[model samples]
Target: MREISLDRLRTLVAIADLGSFAEAARALNLAPPTVSLHIADLEARVGGALLSRSRGRITPTAVGETLVERARRLLVDAQQALDDVQRQVQGLAGRVRVGASTGVIAQLLPQALERLGQRHPGIDVQVAVLTSQETLLQLAAGTLDIGLIALPQLPVKGLDIHPWRRDPVMAFLPARWEPPAVVTPAWLADQPLILNDSSTRLSRLTAEWFASDGQQPTPRIQLNYNDAIKSLVAAGYGATLLPHEASTPLPDARISMHALAPPLWRQLGIVHRAGDSARATAHVLDVLWEQGVE
Candidate 1:
């Protein structure tokens, strides 16, 4: 009996899932003949045919089905073992992958990451700019170590969430449309509005706020990008509502921010995989919280 290689098992699994040698080969970026050779070698070692082939479709035989089941478990164990070894050797030297919403990253992460680099020079940090919803999904999928996101109304299962900061939502008014007194939602709504798209949590919240008040403010323009919305508002195209942190002081002097009287606030938080036992992730979280507090 010969030892089976991990690559051979992976190829087998890929072929089984894809159901064709050519498809599996394309998926694995290998030639079709190489995939056939791997399966053949595995069958020779097992002393039984593992696949039934007809007209280019491939289905696993009885033994092939059994081996495929075991192969999946073996592959998972192998990956866990590799992660363990890398965790031990690198300790905190490898990459710490993080995801954050654009608003959070713009307001928070850059300074935190800079300070973290000063402290732990060995650890590499990679950040993916993602929406709040996308950040949560990526964290759940183990693609990200940490995510900075808006606080959800309901707690997300299988994640540790830490409340970080609460920023008040403010109205961005064009210089020409400045009101003599405090801004009212109804008054603000009457002007041409540049609003965030429906896909964003912020947009949803804003929509609900208007609906609850029985007010329907037709947006003159709908935009998804924060910068674009801000630019349009500053150019006197329309007024917008956004978190105070998301609104930067414009050098053009056309954009002015006013605090809402009733005070709508967006809570920001740091989310991580629940019970994740990675030191690099912990360190990054610490740096994030420290920077947020300052």
Candidate 2:
């Protein structure tokens, strides 16, 4: 029996995760025919079919499922081994994959990465901007070295979350619209709102706060990008509620921010797999924690 090469194992794992040969090929930067050939060769070596294809969906056979589980562990171990060697020779030279929610990516990660790059020029940082839930999922899957996300009221399983910063939520008002001296939830609800889309954790938390108060502001518009929302408010489209980071330095002279009466705040943090043994990941976490404190 021939041993499975790391490249072939990675191809198999990607196919299983993505559920299609074409997608797996794209991910690995290999032609679709090459992906198919690798899988066929692996199946021959293993003496059984690995995937069952029908209706544009590929399902793993029992043996395929078992192989996938083992392959994932093997791949992680292989990467970790490489990381260990790279650290000794080059001192934090390997790439670190990080995931973060849209808010953190916009407000926090840029400065943090700038400082990290200054300290460790050899380390390469790759970032993925995703929703909070998607960030958590990617972190758990070992695809991301770390995740920056909003702290939900409840904790997630199989992850270690460290509180990094607390940012106050602020109300965005059009430049022409004079906001109340002290904005309350009730007062803010009375205005036409340009709100964050419901897909975000901030939006959900804001919605829950409104639900608790038995008030629902009819949205004049819903948007996901903080910068775009700010631009719209500046254009006199509508007011929005956002974290202080997003509301600060009003791009247009007409826009202003007022603190909420109750002073709502959101906690942001660094999260990672509960017991990641990779030293590079640990170093990157330390760098983030240090930058976050500044």
Q: In candidate 1, what are the lDDT values of residues 84-190, reduced to their tens digit?
A: 66864555456788887666676677778888888777678898888888888887888888888877745778988888777778788887775747666667767
- Per-candidate TM equals 0.66, 0.66
Instruction: Identify the runs in model 1 with alpha carbons over 4 angstroms from their true place.
Output: 1-91, 246-252
| Model 2 residue 279 CA deviation in Å | 3.3
Candidate 2 weakest ten by summed lDDT: 245-254
Best by TM-score: 2
lDDT at residue 266 of model 1 (Cα atoms): 79
> Which TM-score value belongs to model 2?
0.66
Cα lDDT for residue 222, model 2?
85
